[model samples]
Target: MSYNSRTIDLILKAQEPNQKQFTTFQQFFKSNNPPPLLFEKNITPKNVKAQRSFSNKTQDSIKETKRKSLSQLKYPEYRMLKIYARIKPGECQLNYDKQSILIETNPYNFDRVFEQSATQGDIFDIVAKQTVDDFLNNINGCLIAYGQTGSGKTFTMFGESSNPGIVLRTFTHLFSRNQETIYVSILEIYKDHVYDLVSGVQDLKLKEDLQLGFYVDGLKKIKVDKLESCQELLQIAEENRHVAETKLNALSSRSHLILTIQMGKTKLHLVDLAGSEKVNKTGAIGETLQEAKKINYSLSCLGHVIQCLSQGQDHIPYRDSKLTKLLMDSLQADCRTSIIVTLSPESKNQDETVSSLKFAQRARFIKKEIRIATQKKTYRDLELEITQLKQELLETKQRMSQTSSVSQFQCRYTTDSEIPCTESLRLTYRSMTNENKENYLPNLKTQENNTQLELENKINQILVELQGLNKEQSLDNVKRQVAKINELTIDMKKTYKVLVSTQGLNNNQLQIQSQFIETQQEQNKQLQKIAEQISSMDSSKPSFNIAINNMIKNLQQQQKQNIEDMQSKLEKVYYDIKKNTTVQDYNLNHLALKLVASPNRQQQQQQQQQIKRSQSKTNINPSVKYLKNKK
Candidate 1:
């Protein structure tokens, strides 16, 4: 068949889906058909975009990776004091760039500058977290915040309960990140004398050890295994910390607080330096004036040390101030230190701000070399650790004893069958403590047998007393007599409860008590019905009628009170039905998120059988305080 070129193309298109072979007129009759090209140069398809090459994509990815690497903080190979500055908010204007702050014309640079708006957590993430992380890798580190009065140095280092500062965060971070036993020593320098904040030892002397540098002699070093222990120490430190009010700032830290945390071989020193203040501007007098002078001189001494370190002077003056003396090792060039320079943004305090900047800028020049602090554990630390272990073992044994007692009690007493039977009563008697079984079980058995009879007798006596009321007696006298009888029944109930709680009644006694309560309720209802019947029969006699009416009202009130009391007791029994169920899961949920979740009951049993773990080493009730603080 003959066809046009368009028709031949159409014939090929029509057969594209069927995949059947077809002899086209073009292939069949054409002289020659050229082969398709293998490759084309820059020939764009109709309505199509060009694809990017793999090399270009790789180049773009490499650029992004480089950008991220530049921004991210890497653990420094050489340990040096890194200076970071933070600006305090005020009415006056202060200029700043990415890592530098300006005081009018003079420009000062730092490793990084945090604006006043940065949160406590933000500061911790960029500053303390890295130190803690590296400390775990066995690097000794020190962090200090230095600034003038009312410059937010204390606030940055030690914040409110709701907003935890860096020190608190560091404690928690170290505990969470490490399994090693940590030793914490807290102290403060108040007016040129050192005082142990933890033990409240006044005028503690600083001593230099061959292995340990600048150790505080007789400074109580406590082993803190948990954050709560650290918190308790911090709380004690805060209470003992010398603080006073001034015109410049209220509750100014009068003493420089230093917290030394020992993790394995490495020690992290967290220092909250006392505010550097000008006595003239702060309006100080007497002791406050003396304190200011001492603080300024000590800080000046520290500045001198920093200046020498920055200038690479060989004759380093370490004994200039007691503050510097205590921090001799931490101030060494090998120590990995981070200095947070807090500044006042107020234009009025421009000079103090400039001075703080100068201190930090000098710190930037002091190079850090890695120091290996592989000191052996002390005798005191080992003794404390041993004492803690013993206490823990005792607690564990106590818990195991309680759990065993509870389990045995449940297995013996908790049954689906009825407990009122004589055989079951005998079983309960057998389950009692040896002393109770010998002394009290027989009396309980006797009471159990006679309980129904006694209830019956009381009911009969009540009816007889009501029916045989003396006609000659005054109404008041009869009412008083009736009240006395009701009081007797209440006394019996009180006695029964005392026996149940004090003597540790068996399930037999409890079940009997439960029955007694039920029977008593029924008896009250029956007594009410009897009173109604008697009142209905004797409505004709006016005097007797009035007495009976009062009697009925009294009886009703007593009945209601008795019913409520019985109901409360029964509800208490009901509440305690699930007592054997472990509440650790719920209790753990009530605690802070940092607390470890309770192990499975089976796992606990296995652990109790195996290694017999030690109890908590610290005295801080972290769960209680954390929840309280959170609330």
Candidate 2:
């Protein structure tokens, strides 16, 4: 048999099923008297063209199916799917506008579509601002970024360079609008293992709390004061995140990163999912391959959950995967959610892009039952706030009183004619006091010092009684003490007001009056100190109460004596003024007597006793005349 060169080549290239066929081919090729073989034409130009056309049509059909699968999704019409087309590596053509992406014959519709050229600011305004607003209104919100490996999921959620991403912007807006404390926690889920990125807790467990829902056990939650603080933490978490090199991406995150922002009762979850990728394409090996499988499985479980939620299925497989379990609370029907599905425009990543779109579509059908978290303030917090405000008010009032007193004193001395005091008498008294400081200062000082000792003894007795009262720790006793303190404070204020009104004296009288005023101020200070200590007392620390009680009782007794002594001195001065009508200013004397006569009932009882004893020694008719003239 003779064989053509083409036939021989075909026979050599084709594998033989049996040894007989191979032996026959070898014998035919070696023989010179080979059979003449006519070569059969297996391929024609027309057939080749037809096959190429079939291949083209089949690809078109596949592309059309992918487009229709996303576009023809029968999800809930109330919520729109937000899709962003990220320019993948080696992508040349931009098939996306600001609103939608064109995929062959069908357009993948979205609420808003961001192209490769879109800025972080643009994305923040379109997507994040609304979420921040919802958060401000106490709405439970979840914003998630999902895509394939190297699809810019992290960059979208947390941007690079100076352009801030959604999480930072949300914090900035939240703090700017409301100055409430913001709490933050960062964690990553890998291979069904949860780890704290902030505190470096390894193998953190997911715990289902009845009150807090699903939370990572032992996760470190930090109280953030400013946007810069949160940004710093985010950087730290990024450094601590589980990431490694892969065939698909040089620095691919191997775990799902969940950033939770707690604002009072409302919680905002910014989740950046590990991009779904093909195990074969990623070329993962050993532990990397295992992690990739876990990532893919958890992500697939999330999709299944979304589908079940969209279909209103009862048996939604939330507990099937750790990722889904963590998201179960945030993805509920009542939560406000937004999913940013990143895509690649490159033809090479078409498969991943289609899969991501399908997942995003499934998420869009889920009807989130939008609910705002109800914030409730505990009784203790409210009580603390009230106490804080009261302290502030008291301090402010003290400051105002000091300022007003200084202003009044300056006004009285600067223009003596406007007040009841004669300017010459004032100068004379100023000179006398300056010269005779040793005489006046020491005498009053010694008296005040001695009064302090006696007052201290009485205060010690009061404190012993107070200690006994406090030992009961009964609410009724606390209420009674508070009421008693309030009554005492009111009486002190009244006495101080009466003393303040008795101003406008000559220089000599002013010196005496200032000494009295100084004594009253000291008493007021003691009262304030005691009141503050009582107000700030903590029931848990009984030692503080006993110490404050012991320290202030003597001061309280001294203040009571000082007030009585001041009234007595005022009455004596009035009698002296009545005896000496030769004094410079009759108006001053009249004003002083009128102020002394009009004391509150607490002072009246003491004054009445002093009046009966003084009636025989001094005629009251002149003082009564001074009071009537003043009126």
- Give the per-residue lDDT digits (tens) of candidate 2, residues 79-113: 42234445544564447666666666556656777
User: CA lDDT of 271 in candidate 1?
Assistant: 94
The lowest-lDDT stretch of 10 consecutive residues in candidate 2 is 35-44
| lDDT for position 372 in model 1 | 47
Give the alpha carbon lDDT tens digit for every residue of 1-631 in model 1.
Answer: 3445654455344223233233432354243432112112111111011112322344455554553343243444654678898887657578887589977687899888998788899899987888887666666789999998888878888889999889999988887866567899989999999999888999988888777767788988799888888899899999999999998899899989899988656778999999998888989999999999999999999999999988999987888888888777788844578999988888888888888888988888887664443333344444554465455445434433432333243344344232223333444354444554455434543544454454455445444444334231334444454455455444445534533453356675577587655656555565556545554453325666676667657666766576456545544542353253235422322222212112255653443332212113223233333333533
Per-candidate TM-scores read: 0.48, 0.47
Q: Give the TM-score of candidate 2.
A: 0.47
| True-structure RMSD, every candidate | 36.8, 38.1
Rate residue 499 of model 2 by lDDT.
35
Regions more than 4 Å wrong, model 1: 1-79, 371-631
Q: Where is model 2 more than 4 Å wrong at Cα?
A: 1-94, 375-631
Residue 552 error, candidate 2, Å: 61
